[model samples]
Target: MALPIITGFDKGDTMKRILTSIFAFMLVLSLLTGCGKKPVIPDDDDDPIPTEFTAKVIGNTSGNLMNGGQYAEAGGWVYYSSETFDESTLTIATGLFKMKSDGSSLVKLADGAYRSINVVGDDLYALTQDGVFTMKIDGAAGRILPGISADPMGMILVLDETIVFLTQSGEIYRNSIDGKNPKELADVNAYGFYYQDGWLYYGINDASYTIRKVKMDGSSTTDVSTGGRDFVFADKRIYYRNMMDNANLYSMAMDGSDVKKISDVDVNSINTDGRKLIVSSFTGVRVLNFDGSDDTVLSDEYAVTLSIAGDFAYFVSQDFSPQHNKLSLSSGTLENILKVRRIDPQNDVVMGSGISDPYIVRMGDWIVYRDSGELTKGIYKVKTDKTSKTKLIDAYAHNLTLIGDWIYFVNDSLNNYLCRMKIDGSEKGVVIDLPVNDFVMKDGWIYYTDLNEIKIMRAKMDGTLISVIDDSDALGEIKLSQDFIYYQTIGMEAGNFGIHRIALDATRKFTYLDDSIQSFIVDTEWIYYTTKVSENELPMQIVRMNLDGSQSVVMDYFDEYVNVIGVGDGMLYFETWKNEAGSVNRMNPESGQRQLVFTSDLRNDHTVIFENNLITLKNNEDGSVNVYLSDLDGNNRLLIVE
Candidate 1:
């Protein structure tokens, strides 16, 4: 989900304009598409097939719960509260409701300025503008939970005796059901609360937007990092949106440990029947294990399908294109395709196209690629066999990585903010917003270079921005290890670059690794960099030094060109270029044994070698750059995307 921008109402007004335009467009479509044609109903004897008249009014404005359902459940009944933003002549607002599994038995349990609700036992306890109230299943006699905050955000039934709720001040509390001595548990200030087992969980609205859990007594507090997303309780665990990454699903224990990100895409909703977890991503619905194993999409896939799983999924899938076939992956069959009606995104624009840096990452099922194309930009998840193509999101995206079920990326549409969505395109939220360039991630945190000031910034997966690790604007080529992050900071003098290091586990206090260098790379034990002596001279040598800035020596005897390095398979692979031609060189780091792997033609300047082989961009005689792969045996082959 995109992070909420805490800005002025100007952007909100702009969004309202956009939404108004959409509404006008939909209104026009309904008038033109339906009103223009009226089917002549024959008399009772000649009527079409003797079926009852069926009319469905589905619109963002005037829709019963067709495709727009708020929640989902597996075995348990799903509860939803509905209020029309604009309804009829009166403009109705503020209502609380519940529904059965299959969109039946919609019971309006409360009304008039109710905030949120909690279901415990046969009663629904919800917050109204004035106070908290409880009512029976059929909206029968109601009574107030006396002596609770009137400004309650929501309610959670932790146990028979306890009710946890959030106040307008962002504070959380747990009190007896009778409201005896409500005790302040925590001050989230920006988030609400959820109760599971003996722990109380809440989202911290500070630098990380991180969800955390604590013992009911508030003795132990632990960060349950769901990449900065919100949490839903089901099947003895907390399922949450990946706060910092896209299209991700995660869950953890109630006590905050044993956190596991379960889905690869944005899990739109989760319904767990204790035995199976039915989850909905943007593309469709699937069932997963509580531990996030054995995930299977439960919906049919003829046309594009959105959310699905169990009942909640069944409700959510109604929102997708009407023409959908039930897809049975087990039998590889598509049947009962439904004819759907939809408002296409393409209809809003005439012609649009762009290209994205195709990023490939290895996760659960296959190698996922976020095709960063401009016009076709979206996060696409396909099995390694190239089957089951799920369009995660159509929003503009940048670099992406899949950690567990979520894909973290930079959304260009949202100010290049770090964002994530469910792999199925649900729960699109921001991780953090940064004015940065060339961002990267390690462990669970994001690191990037903000172009405006050259300072490096860090944030959690859930849209919480942390400036704890600030550096000078001259920073570049930053890389992080488990313990330290290394980068080169350009000095104020023209052509002066110095190696720098900062302990990751510490408070981000940086220390210069070396004061004498132009560019460098840090390995486990050594630092390799390029430097020159005189002002006019280019790189005089590629030098190696201890990480502590001592015991420096020139390694590669090269001058006047660009050098690239990679280390793998117990060897150091380096590329040195003379103009546009480059040679692939290798060295055994331990023995100092240097050897030339291979050399490419002058046209192949940008060469990369991996797995003891060379790969280069070859400019063929036809004036096109084609990539070629070659091995030590002199066997070369052209690599094509197709």
Candidate 2:
């Protein structure tokens, strides 16, 4: 698990204190800058500077536990060991467990036990306790491949219905996807392979990571390259970065001749959009012509991971510094055009101040976003066309809602203070300070979850802490109305998640929302939520419920799985995975109709807020996690804006 807070420091003037502390830390960081600083020895009578330290835990990962073993991907499904193990009890099994990418739908594929699994096309191949066998993805009919020992790393790639695989003892074999034409490829440990056109390029452990080519007919072998590290094929050439001193990008032809070094100092990852070679590392993102000349740093941010689409380069910035993150792109030796500029325009909360997490709202010609530069995480306002900016107050802002000329928001970084400010960055004042999370506004009050409890906090359009009702029972996701507040409660029953509900007022006792529910949301008469009932050891339902905890129904059921629930604009969105192939889906909260907005066979661990027809998310595409944006309908693809 990672830390809950970003280094546990609050944002604002608190950040100024942190900046001041950086000067004290300068002596320690001198070595990283290759600078030698004169050291001053303290006198024996001098007092030592004291340092304080604390640790915070975040990100609960208790539910999802993965079994360690060799597995292969086929479509969206992963077939792996389902055998539960108790280390102290010495229990293990080889049974097969099939699951989707988002960890929703899981099922036991087969009984007994198995060693490992490899999948291709529609066939599931594995070595069972009985023998090597083949099955369908949906767990229908299965049969053992007679007399064949199971390859630990079962299958690699397919060519004309024939499967090539690696066994545990560093041997290669060729067979049909359904197990036939078994033959050995001498005695070599094949680590990786790529099938392009009619030629099969495979990397084997000979002397030191050698690449050899063979025809589809298993004819004579030809050596391609040897003594390279971290190789990838792109644009009909094998591009690899050296592991030895003075790392550089090196590329070779298909026939392994005319080997050339492209750049020194480690090119991180390279991609080709058919025209330009987009390469990036810790330094920045760069675009190069095919001939390896005219390279330009296309981005100003600390470009770490990148993907190129057409003329746009989607790059992620690693520098999370508060003051200096303006994304810009250029071409032609650090002179590219600035196509899309995402300006985080700052208002004069106070001049020369930095703002973080802008929550913008519109009122008349002025667009308002919470800015906390001067007033310690307060509210700020600016024009809609990026014309002017100004700070309203020095209060912590959270859960912002706009009403008429004033912007309603919670300044909770400090004692849950409610505040309001004009859209034109003027007439800033306080409303109330109330503890809340996941809040919604209805009629006049702000209904929200407050520290494991749900409450309705009513305050004037100024900053103040007003308590409408502070219920004791834990609640989450509160929605407010003129007369009532509806919320949900979550508790642990012997480590299993349970759900409940209650009203906004302290007089109304808690109500039984559901005996069992995974997650749920409420708005007036309707309640939208999800539930999981393990049938065959796999949870398979995304459910909905009424506000009164009655008439709960399963909206969508799948054989795979769905995780992460978010709702916006009457649409419920979550990431769903069939088998192990992951995708994002959005459904009509009223009709429960669903559509796949984005899909990929990658690890997507982040789903941020839905804003302006775009949902920001972070996914691990190449080797690093990167931020991306997808549309509400999931039509427009994500891009890397540094």
Candidate 3:
């Protein structure tokens, strides 16, 4: 999903105007295409003949699939966003397409980013970056619905000719199917919504997180009950999973009376078909009576989203390799329906926002990196040209370094430990059984800072020859040179925090090269670092010194604190922050000439210089991080995610 400048009322009002205009334009286009007839409603006689496998898929395909959400399916045809994954961004390109139930006669439906897909009668409704749009089952006469600008959060429900959706800011709106007579139903800070029997049910966004309901005509809004995440109306009662009770299934009467618990396990998602409740929980897929009896486990594999159609319960697996599967609700058998392939990042640009701490390292023809997305954290590798992407490990990994046939990394399990595994992701074991802050490899040995002891330690590749190199408790970043271990240490006195170098064998004591150092990078001939002259000043100077600490010179200075990125192409690349904005700058180490290369809202503290491209890890507004690739001059930017 693209990041929008999310302001409260201003953004909402602006979107309203934009949606009105777009809908007007769509109406004109519809007339020109001879689709000005009333919204088509399938008559009882013309209703799709309910087949034995009449279940239809509905929801956003691309974003939802990546985040484990549902897409659209109906009438023996399944529609979804088929996107190529970009390793740089850890996301997928936006493209919607459809295929037959037998996986034949595939066809393209639309081109662009979309979410919240719903199939109503014989038409499809979806939310895009701009607004809502509707198209026929065959993808013709597509037109945007008017009078809505805020992005919808969950499924778009169409009931009794009225379309209902919730905005990101918790506002719910209702509109006619023809994009007319829109009304603001309620603004109870809602997160999810459902419509049944002339009443709209919604879950609130508050400390108690209660469930509420109101008439479809925007009247008599009242608190229905407390404690639920999502609602599924069935058997004349509203069934929901208790958010305050580990997402266990629960149900209540239409008037929010006679509430009862129906399950004991934690659930990730839940759906019902009047008689039975299908739920995906940590224990696996299970079905139970509406009153929480006769529980039967369907599959041991973790499931994501699920739907019920005829006698089959379809769900996607919640694992590294997500696959769509169908279960025979009666026979209790399971079958594979389709294997959802990971998007290829080279040919596709995927955009998303989130908090991230991605690190990258280049090895042979592949660039291995760790993607720290909230939902899709893992270690992935892609070719230099952004092709042949593969996920080598399905865990949160960092500080990647290649040594011979093994890849050493810090795995964040219970505690951060130095772990090693074959490049093919086999025979994985902890090399250092202690918590480590940082590590570097040299001459078949690993030098690292132990987080638990706060000391510098070393061990062989086979976890032998363990020894403490330094007993300092203030060790910072560690890097290895030819015969010296260069690192930073915090000092008790001002101007004492400096760069120190010691012999690799721990025979020589600490040797100080520069003081008041903020960050530094080691090159073949020079050590590029940032130093603060005083505690009261905001500016920091970029300094370069010969490896032997001779001929020290100031390369450049910035008004804000500077962080050394790396040195490449005869230029020193660094990032500076001012007014909460980050800018990438490069300077000639010899001439001291500097220029701004790129600017962004994200701080570029972690970066890798690969060939002629600079890969950076940047934060997104939606609590995700994106890896972006650009030339040395910050041009020709591309996103690569495996």
Candidate 4:
């Protein structure tokens, strides 16, 4: 699916070229066919269907089938289309046509690329390169539907007098038959839709793998199950493919209960004729009993899509030269055949937000980060192996912290409140009602300095049990140690400016660690922090104190105060000296030795460390910063995103 801006859709250069060529061809055709009778497209409000029209009962062949569902077999004929747009004439050649089941009697219904094809009464309705249109099934009197736009990213469904489609711009709109009085049903990245028994069901992937159903009136939406498109509703049961289960077949009751794995035979698309299922797969086209028994291979030719209408099922090949073939369901005979993304810093355009500090988080094998660059400004997740990168949600996000199966972050676009969603970008919701200043997670509890309250607060992972842990005027950030919460604090009168600690559990014991803490990080057995000496001439002090207050030792002194950025493996520390613009250095805690290993503008904050790697920013000459993932020693760097 082409994503919209944030939710934007990318038409890409290929779509542009196809449209351009279509326009060129259409101009010539119009010039050659001038003075010909125009196709009469009816408007229900103005040019209603003739009373003699039957609004026939031909099947709507759409699902996971190849052709993205632009093909259907009905009424002893197989319908197909391939059309394009004309920019100069501002017209869409619908390109609707059909052929006999045996590939004979070729007939053109309309012109150009068409999708969402449906046969109702004596006419056919479909979306062309430019917009929604309708025409007689015999390829006559066709006209564009009055206000509907073109190129919907997802399948469109016609429900009695109403029509529904997912626009490329990311909205599912419902309109009257004449394309009048459109109402937005939802904002979705849907691919398939079905209306049955007063309910409308659609397959959407914006959140999680889910098939959702809503009342025909657009009320009471409910997630049907964890399945994808190409599902079929028959015998009062919904047969769907569970993508999480290797794209295998499954069956469930109407209320989404009694789910049973029907078959382990994986498939790309599926169709059914009451008792048997016709499936398209890499292996070939096959048929089997409804329970997945008595499986039979009808054709050894691989098909990417499968569509059934009336007595036949049609499929397209997955080869270089794709052949659109038809099959007789009763005879099980067939004919016809047809046949990442990685990031490179040099050739690929690596964008940055131009902000010095890029908020980065490491979630398992994926690094989810925030970018504010002109072209790629959003929250995106890229695998550590450079195998895949996906935009999660199209919104301003920050402080991406991972806990359990969820990535917790502040929605900078939604009042800075803490929000969370699954790593797959599903089940997103605001975690806390109040704004969060900064936060740290331990176990399943979220400890943070509440921005509105300006005090240390604690809450469970689900945003419950919200309690004020410390009423003191908190400073800097929150850190989670083994048993205590470490934070900088100052009294209401601005006195007592230093680091303090409190128990993580119920005791909540508070202890004053020291005064004038330049920076600090908690360790398993000791507390490592930085403090400045009295005289400006004196070197800064690096202090290490035991958790039980056993002994205090000055680890070493630096020429200037430093910020303890992060603790790598063992007793090694990553730091930035001078407390301002300085080089990031790696320090050996046991020997008190430090070496300049990386550059840092500080952002004056702790860096993100996970999976034995660290993230840092490199400033470029053009005021843009490129984020890189580096080893603990600041070597073997890789660009984070493209």
Model number with the top lDDT: 3
Off by over 4 Å in 3: 1-69, 82-91, 101-105, 273-275, 297-642
User: What's the CA error at residue 395 for candidate 2, in Å?
Assistant: 8.8
Off by over 4 Å in 2: 1-397, 412-416, 433-438, 448-465, 490-510, 514-518, 535-540, 558-572, 577-582, 588-593, 599-632, 636-642
Per-residue alpha-carbon lDDT of model 1 for 273-373, expressed as tens digits? Answer: 44656555556656677777887766633111122223223231232112223333344344432221111222121111111122444344443454444
Which residue window of length 10 is worst by lDDT in model 1? 57-66
Q: Would you list the C-alpha lDDT of every candidate in the order shown?
A: 0.49, 0.47, 0.63, 0.61
For candidate 2, lDDT tens digit of each residue in 1-642?
000011212111111111112123432443343222111222442221111211121111000000012233345655554333222211122356666543348787776444334555566755433345678777878886643443322223434345554454445555544443455543465544545545556666554557787664455578888755435566777765544423467778888898888777466545555555666665676667666788777654444333332234433334221111112234332222211121122221221101112254444544444433332344555543445656565555556666544455655443353444555455444343234454555434444555423433443223223465654344454544334555555555331234444344445544544445555544556666555566353556776766555577777776666664556677777776665688777888668788877775535444434354443434333322233444567665554321
**lDDT per residue (tens digit) for residues 1-642 in model 3:** 111111112111212212211133443443454432323222433222111211132232221222212355567776654343333322234466777755578787887644556776677777654556778878898988765443433345655355677554557776566655556678666656765555667777676767888876677788888876656776777777687786778889988899898887877667764467777787888889877889989888566556554455666555422444777777778875542222122222112111112278766676777766656676776776778877676666677876666667877631365776666766666666556778877766678888766778987765667798987654687877677778877657542468777777886755555367778888888888888767856778888888887678887767887788887788888888887788888887767778888886545346667677788766454424566778999898777642
For model 4 the local lDDT of residue 386 reads: 69
Query: If the candidates were sorted by their TM-score against the true structure, best first, what order would they fall in?
Result: 3, 4, 1, 2
Ranked by lDDT, the better of candidates 2 and 4 is: 4
TM-scores for all candidates: the values are 0.38, 0.36, 0.47, 0.42
Give candidate 4 misplaced runs (Cα > 4 Å): 1-67, 73-77, 82-95, 99-105, 337-642
Preferred candidate (TM-score higher): 2 or 4: 4
